[model samples]
Every structure is written in structure tokens, then in C-alpha cells.
Target: MNGPDPSRPCLTPESPPHSRGRSCPPSDQLGNSSSSSATTPATDLDSAVQDNIFAQAPSETSSRPLPIPAANALRHLPSPPLAREACDGGARPSPQRNCCDGRPAACNHRAVSDVCASLPEKSFARHFLTSSGTFPSAAEILKKAAFFNSGNRPHDALLLCNAGLEVYAEDADLWNCKGVTLRALGRLQEALDCCREALRLDPGNTNALNNIGVALKERGELLQAVEHYRASLVANPHQPTCRTNLAVALTDLGTKLKQEKKLQAALVCYTEALTADPTYAPCYYNLGVIHAETDDPHTALQMYREATRLNPSYVEAYNNMGAVCKNLGKLEDAISFYEKALACNANYQMSLSNMAVALTDLGTQQKASEGAK
Candidate 1:
């Protein structure tokens, strides 16, 4: 009872310790708190356990960088935030919705999967185009395709692009639009080819370049993705989304570098990412991780705080703050940060484990104090 109530209803591995139990003890109790009922004795072994829990940063698997999808230049939507990375030990949910379908939304809507279910793919474009003898202009067709693609009708969009291409073979926009639809449908190679064709027609096509970057990134070609993203930015520096995409690619590459223990090189990548998109929250979180790795807890805390400020629902950042605080011997602050993380995600196991460990340590320290008295 002096530490955590193991019998608490929601104290399972799947739930945070603070999800359903007594809140963390008051910070003022750090100097003196009742520990007579402490279950774990104060020993070097307890210290070792605490060290093991807080000293080692979470594994890369627990906090790998999330992939940022390339901006859909054809869709013409608002710039989306960079993808959120898992800072500590939880899977970050993707920020996409299944367009009224039951599949994972990351598939860019359920329609992308079943778009051809109702119609025959081979004749769909022919019927759609030939049926209207006086076909719309290439611009009109591209507009309609974009509308359909944005409306989650990627199959219809693809057909429109195909029919339009038959008439307007040299239209770069049509090819780019088709590439977007194909990518949405999981046809990465075809999508890449289409985007390449668009680029061939218009050598400076920003949309096609960005889409190609996306396809390449998906294909695990990070360096190529970065190159294309940079080219997209060079074509039109005003594109905020492209800037974000560049930052994301850099962060991803930096994460790989960090995993490889190339700390200085990784730092350069992260710094460049910040330069690319100053407001990107995940970049800040990644910076915090790097600073923490370099034994700079204060800087790490600031970076984590900035990340949480920019994105309040960042459970991983909060969990990491708690871990850093615990390592710095700020047990009260660590518990508070863990509580904040649990507030964001009640089922965050890392924060739960960390909170329990911090509470146990606090209890042991109090017991030691009383015995000394």
C-alpha cells in the first residue's frame, strides 16, 4: 500500500499503473513519507533493479521513427503534420481513417482496396471515356480525377486518369494523378512508373517528384527519398508539406544512423531536419532522444517538453520525460511525468512500468530514512 497496489483492478500489463489506483504521492513527501509497509526492502539489489529500469533507454524497436507519407501533391489538401514517432514504448497509431471502409485507414481508405470490386477493371476506362464521345478537356479530366481521388474513390480516379491519358497522352498532370491513385491502391511500382512518366513529360514536376519520393521511401530507399524530397523543395520552396516530408525523411535517416551508433552523423541529420521544419514535433522528440543518449538530460527534458507542447497527445514524449526525470533522481517529477503520460494513454505499458518502479524506489528511500532516524 505504501508503493503501488498490485491488486488494483487495472494494474494488468496492458494498463498503466496510474490508470486505476492511488495517484502518485505528493512531491513534498520526497523528504519524509510513510514506508513502514514497503514490500520491497532497501538493498543493493533494489538499487540495481531501479538502475536497470531507468538507466537503459528504451530499445529502438520501442521508439522507432514513424514514417511520414509524401505529400499528395495532386490531392491539394492542407499540409499534414509530420508523422508521430513512438518516443518510449508504445505503438503510435497512424493518423489516417478508412474512408467509410473497414480496412486499416493507412491503406488510404477502404475504397482503394475494393474500388475494382463492382466494375471490370479492363473495360472500366474504355466505357467511362467512350461513353462520353465529346470528352472533357485534359484539365477537366484531371480535375475530376483529383476530386475522385480526394473523395476516396481512387478506383474511379484511376479510371478517369487512364481514359484522359488515352486522349491527352502527353499531359503530365494526368500521369501524376494516376500515380497518386495507383500508390493509394498499393501498386507501388506502377505508381512509381507513372510518376516517373509524369516527370519525363515535365522535368520539373514537383508533384511527380514528391510522389516518386514517397514511392521510393516506401520501397526502403531512404537516400533516394531524401533526394527526391529535396528536389521537390528546390522546384517550389513554398510547399510546406514538401518541407515536412523532407524533414521526415531526414529524421528517418537519422534514426537509422542513431541505431548504427553513428551519434554525430545522426545529430547532423536531426539538426538539418529542424532546419527543414521548425514546427515539427517529432523532430523535437528525436532530438531529445539523441541528447539523452549523449548524457545530456537537461537538454533532453527541454526537447521532450517542446514536443509535448506542440502535440499534446504525444504519450511517448511524456513517458520519455518520466524516464529522464527518474534517471536524474527527480523521482517526484518522474512520477508526475509518468502520470501525465498515462493521462494521454491509459494503456501505455512503459509509463505504467516506469511509474511502478519510481514509486517502489520512493518507498524504499523513505524506509531507509525512517530506519536512519
Candidate 2:
């Protein structure tokens, strides 16, 4: 697949740690500050202000693009695995040989004597020539199709896939690829059909299973999506994308349940996701949010801290950590967390707005306490 377009910059890059006026020691070069003693409110507030001015932006993954492959190369691939087997089953001789009239035989000479049998019989080579016109190989077609799909030309990809199927109709990988392209095109029903066909040909095809799961999820069939995701994981447990997708589906289900006040069930889903991938920062962040919403600020802060520790560049975790600190009346801690988030991502508007609010609160509390003196 082609990389992202060069002209379209999707993500913003983060700033260097030293840019925000914080001297992160060489030991903390990776920004793995999981724990630190709370600083004074004034010091934290000052750092937060500096962070707001110098924070970096989030970077996009796809920045450079590549050219698409040619369609001519795709029409010459080998026949489908099933078609090869059929040819090997003594169904017919090679297509390169001429028959009685110097034309390719539709059926072998042996079958011609039995008119009844011959009427229903067909030669593999004849079928192959009819489908692909004896041209480009299967691998070439798949490559071009993939190139088109990656370049956001799903319709062109689908057309190439269809043309390739004429020669290798029973190729499970081609079917799976077709399904993926169709899914990208938002033709969910067609994508499901393609995936099903692939699965029928190769029951353990993980790509087909994953594509089917995605289609089911898009159609709002959450439970069905779960089944497909589980099957996909069974087929290929090492696929992190599948695990992440399953977690997302579970999280969506949990969200619906939570709206119905099913907090315990939501927690279970979140817990399952964490168990599946402890290093997944989003899961930790979501868990922290849930805990915060449930009025357990201490648990929320701990989760947020864990998330930030795992991924020091997680701006959301830092922002949430600051919010929790503010709620707990730990104004200084909140300011420090907010400043760190701003340092990580300058365009983090929420951190900037909240930092301002926290400063105002700290100032008001300070003046009130001074007045009492």
C-alpha cells in the first residue's frame, strides 16, 4: 500500500522536552516520570504557563505517498489453487495443445465419446483462457489492487479485484483483499459477502474474519462483531490490530451499558481490555475517565498516572490527571500535570483553558487565605 499523501499533513509533531523550561534530567530523558513529590502551587502554575506557550503538536502517521501499481501486471497471475487442483484431477489436458480443429478443446477427447458426460464437462485451460484471456499473473493483480486501495481509490481497486477473480476466482486471499476494499468503500453488505466467500474457501483466514468483524461492527451488530473478532483472534492471536479492534467493540458495548447505569459491566469490559493489552494507553485513559465519572477521584488519578507513565506523550492522560488533582484540592499537583501536557502538545486547547482556570482558582484561594491572616 502507498504511504499517506505528502501534500496533506494530518498530524502535528510534539515539541522537545527542554523547550518548556523544564530541565528533565538525563535519567528522565525518555520522560518516564511516573512519580514525583508534589511541588508548590506557585511553581506548578509558572511551569504550566510556560508549557502552554511551548507545547508541541500531535504528529500524523502518514505523511509521504507512493505511486500506484499498473493494472496490466495483474491479469497474468496463476490460476486459483482450487482450479489447479481441478486440473490435476484428470479433468483435461494442457490448454497449449490444439484439438481437432486446431482450437483449444472445451473438453478432453476422452469425454467427447460420452456426449452426456461431455455436455456437462469443461477443460481447466479453456476456463482459464476465458477468465483471464491468458494474461498477467495473480500476484501482479493483487499488488495493483492493494496499491489502488491504499491510495484511496477503492472503486478502482474493486474493479481490478473483480478482473483478477476471473482468473483466480477461488483464491481466498484475493477474496479477503476484495472484502477489505469494499469495506473501505462503505459497501458493508458487499464486503460481508466477499469476506464470507473467503472464509468459505479458507476457514482459518484471519483477514476475512477481521474484515467481517469490522463490517458487523459498522452495521451496529456489536454482539456479532464480538463473535467475528474472537474468531479472528483465534485464527491469529498475534494480530495486535484485531485485539485493539475487539477492545474497541467491547468499549462501545460498555458505553451503551453505562448509559443504562450498568457501571459494573462497563468496568468489566474496561478490565478485560486492560488484561488483553496492559500497554494500551487508551484503555488506561478510558478506565481513568470511568473512575472519575464514578466519583472515585483517587482511583481515577492513579489510572491516569499509570497511563501517562506508560506513554509519557499521552496528552489526554496528563490533562485528566491535572483535572483530578484540581478536584482533590491539590492545586499545585494539578498545575504540574497540566504543564507537562502542554509541553507534550502545544495545540492541546483543553490543557490551556483548564490551566487558566486552575491558575485563577489557585490565586483566589491564596488571596482568601492571606486575608484570613
Candidate that scores best on lDDT? 1
The window of 10 residues in a row where model 2 has the poorest summed lDDT is 74-83
The per-model lDDT (C-alpha) reads: 0.55, 0.49
Off by over 4 Å in 2: 1-134, 137-140, 344-349
- Worst lDDT 10-window in candidate 1: 29-38
Q: Can you write out model 2's per-residue Cα lDDT over 128-219, one digit (the tens) per residue?
A: 32355434454445555655554446676676667566545666656666776666665769868987886786677665676577566556
- Candidate 1 residue 140 Cα shift, in angstroms, is 0.7
- Candidate number with greatest TM-score: 1
lDDT of candidate 2 vs native? 0.49
Candidate 2 local lDDT, residue 164: 60
Clashes found in each candidate (C-alpha, N, C closer than 3 A): 0, 13
Per-residue CA lDDT of model 1 for 54-141, tens digit only, reads 0011112112223212112321000013222111111111122111132221221333223334446566444454456544555555
210: Cα error in model 1, Å:
0.7
Q: What is the Cα-based TM-score of model 2?
A: 0.61
